[model samples]
Every structure is written in structure tokens, then in C-alpha cells.
Target: FSGTGTNMFKEEGAQQGFSSVTKSIGFSTDSITFGTIENGHLLLFETSSSRKLGEGRDCAYRCQDLESGRELALKMYKITNPDQRRAIFHDLYAQRSQVGKHERIVSYERVIESENTIFVLMELLNGKDLFDVICTEALTEEKARVLFRQLLEGVQHLHRKQVIHCDIKPENAMLLGSLEDGTANLKLIDFGCSCFKEFEADSRGCVVYDSYMPPEHVADSKLSPSVPTDMWRLGCTLYIMLVQRPPFHNDAQTQAGLAARQAGQLFRVPEYEALSPEARGLIEQLICGDPSKRPTCDEALNHPWLGLA
Candidate 1:
């Protein structure tokens, strides 16, 4: 077993209350043939020309689909248990619409399970993740607004579907297209940690990115996790887009950061004051201390700052 059938963090890495992630999956250009016609559809990786996408519980490769003869992202998971593999296949099948309906969310095609491996075929996006953008690109207010509005629309769609993206950080968001051209649209990826509202009631103990998570997720045991958690992560993502840094950083490299996160303290340094008043107000509302006080994705879209309603 991969130990991540129901635990999202075990597969995604860097959980809020768990250990740190340091090792990354590496790939090389070596011609590798993955399957045969007898097994079903074959996935062939021309490693010499293939690109290595980021890793989680599975390794992703930009490869060719022998059946369709189209380029796609192949997410491979090695699971020894047949039952566990079937569970994953069923889980993804149920949420295909919610996750793949909007252009902003990555599309899921089909799942191919073999002897001891599971391969998930998905849309191959041509762009950089928001995390890379934060570290390397400079943005004007207008550009920032364009990117943020797309993000909100994506969240709004998920909420409308009664879905909550528990993990909504820069790393989970991507800008489609060439980074140098800067014309790519934004898309939300990685639904491994997300849950439908009904399913969330039973969902417990998720490892989240500390900076974007709300106080309730880490500190207060009585508060139930819900839509508000996504709101908090959205706000943190926006803050990073505008300032290129998280609003709250409690020495993230050490245990102190985890302690600070568990304490449930959220504050912005002077960098926040420099942003437009409307922008600041939105962030304040999204990261409100009280979960009930935070605006839902629909309400946030209608907020004055976004004028997206």
C-alpha cells in the first residue's frame, strides 16, 4: 500500500502538522516503454525528450498516448493492492465533472490500471505554476487583477459544485502558456486534497500548507473545517501574487513556524499597507478570524475589489 489511499498529505508532501518534504522525483532522458496492447493502452515515454513534471505520491511524465497519438501528462502511481487501486479509480471517476468542467481546472481523461501500477491520463498544460511566477516574475496591478480574477472564478465553480479545494496554494495554481510571453491563462490543478461538502464532514486531519491555512485547521479543535478553509488559502494566494511573499511567515524553515501556525495568529507586515485599500480590505475579509465571517467564493466574486459578479 502507498499509505495515501485516504491521507492526502502522504502523497502530496509537506503537510501542515506533519514532516517536511525534501527529496524530489528526478527523471532522465531514457527511452522507456510502459505497456503493451494486450495490457490495454500503452504509455510510452521518450525520456530523452520527455520533461519531468513535479512529483507527489505519483510521478508525472510528459509522454505520448499510443492510442490517441496525442501529448498528455501521465500520472503514475505504484500501488501493490488491487483494492486500493480500485478505490483511487472510483474516487477520480466521481469527481471528473467537478474537477474537469471548467477550463480553469485541469481535465481528467481516463484511468488505466495494470498489474501493480495505476496511470491517470490528464490534460498537459503548457505553462508555469504560480509558485514559479511568485519567485521569478514581476507583476503590475492590472496583471495581478487578471490572474486573481481567474483564480476566483475557478473557486466559485468548485463551490457551486459543492466542492471545497482544501489545498489552494500557489503551487496548486498554474499559468497556462509561455512564461516569457506572459499571455497564459490561470488554471487550478491538484485535487488530491479536495473534498465534496458532504464528504468533508467525515474528513479529518489533513496536512496543509501552513501559511495559507486558517486558524481553525491548526488550532481550534471545535471549529469544523469547511468552505472557509478554502477562502483562507485563496487570500494567502492573492497576497503572494501581489507582494511575492506570504502575509504571515513564522520562521517557516523550522519548528517555530509550525508552532506559530498552530497558535492561529495571522498578521500582515508593513508590506500589506502599501497595497491598494480595496485589495487590503478583501484580504482582511478572506482571512477573517471567524470562519463564519469569511465570505464565500460567490460573495467574494461580487466583492467591490474584484467587481467580477
Candidate 2:
């Protein structure tokens, strides 16, 4: 198995023993009946070369809907073992439960689980994540305002639905459409870590990105989740957009120690002194030591930093 699968299978009319087909570049897959399509085949991308779209544990591939002829992204998970298969089932349940078609969130198509793997079909986005875009290109304060406002809008939507994105970060914000022009747009992706928590109530910070966690997150295990936690991460994200680096004690060498230090201390970006006072003010309130003092998504949207006040 060369990581990326060709999905070798016994052809429909073979002797069922000795298989000798060597199609490496691309492979045909049997159609699946799910979501709004019946007998729809998610065709492996037709490429001149073999490739996979995403990296790490979760692998995504370009796919097509045979019924509507619409292109989609297929996030595939190989069921290597029984444990992995059970875990995939949990992930699918969480993903489908918390996610749907929203203007700010990535549009979820459907999930198809076969004997060997599970496929998550989603809308195909053509752009880079916010972290990469921020680092590579110089983001003016005004541009940051536009993007951060959109981010807050997404947060607002999630909050309205009582959903908390446990892993909210710039890396999870996918930028697309009008990015090259004066306006900017984004869609929040990766809902696997999202959860439905009671509004203004605490929840277990079970799934989280340590770097983006608020100071309270480290002080008291699971006592600092729900809405405030997401607001804190949004503060971190906005800081990265403007300063082009993570806020607070980010250069602490190791992530574990960094998270520990972040709970106790907070640092102001030296270069951020050049940014607008409103911007600094918002970040300060968002990263306030007390999670209870942090603003809600709607409150953040009204912050003077984004000029929506």
C-alpha cells in the first residue's frame, strides 16, 4: 500500500484469485448512493500525475458527483483496524451533527462509509488557509479588519446554533473568492473538533489547539470552554493577521511549556504598537485573563477595531 490508494479490487468478472492489473496513475471507483444523489460515483481526480490534496492523518482528494456533475472534495479515512473504524464513526457523527450548509462554514455534502474506508464529501474550495496567506502577503490593517469581521460573522453563526469550534484558529480559516480584490471572504473548516455546548456555560475543552487556548484553559482543565474560549482564539487569530505571528509567549520553544506559560503570562506585540489603538484594544479585551470578561461573538463584531461600531 503506497499510502494514497488505487483502491485495488477484484474486477466484476475476474477469477477472484490472481489479480494482475497495474493501473497506477488513476483508478475507477464504484458509485455510492448517498446524500441527494443516487448511484453517484465519486470519481478519483483525473490527473496527469498521482497526487493527494491534503496531508497528515486526514487525506483529501478531488472528486466529482456523477449525478449533478459537481466537483467536490473527498476527505478519506482508511479503516485500518476496528478501533480506527469506530473512531471514524464517531467523527462522522460529530461532523454531520455540528455542520451544515452555512455561508461562513464549509458546506457539508455527505458521508459514505464502505467496508474499508469512510469518505466525507464537501464543497471544493480554491484557496489557501488564513495563516499561510497572512505570513506570505503583507496584510494592511484595513484588510485585516475586513477578514476579521468575516471571521467574527462565522463565530456569530456558530454561537447562534450553540456550537463551539474547539479548534478555532487562522489555520482553519480557508480564504477564497475576492481575496485578490479589495474585499475578502473566508469559510471556517474542520468541524471534527466542534461541539454543542450550552450558551454562556462551561464545557470540557476536550478538543483544542493548545496555542490558541485562552489563559483560563490552562489554569483549570475543562472549566474554560464554550463561547468565551472561541472568542479568545479569535483574538489570537486576529493578532496573527495583523502582527504576522502568534500573540503572547509564542517563542517558548516547546508547545507544552508554551501552553503552561500562556496561562500565567501575557505579552503585547512590540510591533503592534504601530497598529490602530482600536485594534490593540479589542485584542486586549479578547485575551483578558478572565474568560468571563471576554466578549461574545456579537460583541466582538461590534468592536471598534472592525469599524462596525
Alpha carbon lDDT of residue 308, candidate 2?
42
Per-residue lDDT of model 1, residues 1-309, tens digit only: 112122332232211111111223484444433433334533342222245677655447786755567887766555566445433533364345446778788877655444444556678887889888878876655677778888988888887777777789998888987534767689998766666554445545433645566766656544445788889888878888888787776653345654654443445666667778888888878866677788988888787777632
Q: Which regions in candidate 2 have their CA more than 4 angstroms from the true location?
A: 1-49, 80-91, 198-205, 250-266
- What is the TM-score of candidate 1? 0.75
Worst 10 residues of 1 by lDDT: 12-21
Please report how far candidate 2 places residue 240 from its true position, in Å: 0.6
Backbone clashes in model 2, listed as residue pairs: none
Tell me the spans in candidate 1 whose CA falls farther than 4 Å from its real position. Answer: 1-51, 81-98, 178-183, 198-201, 207-209, 221-224, 251-267
lDDT of 2 by residue, 44-137 (tens): 3221113366775565677766556777876655557654443354345435455555777878665544445456777888888898888898
Worst 10 residues of 2 by lDDT: 12-21
> Distance (Å) between predicted and true CA of 227, model 1?
0.8
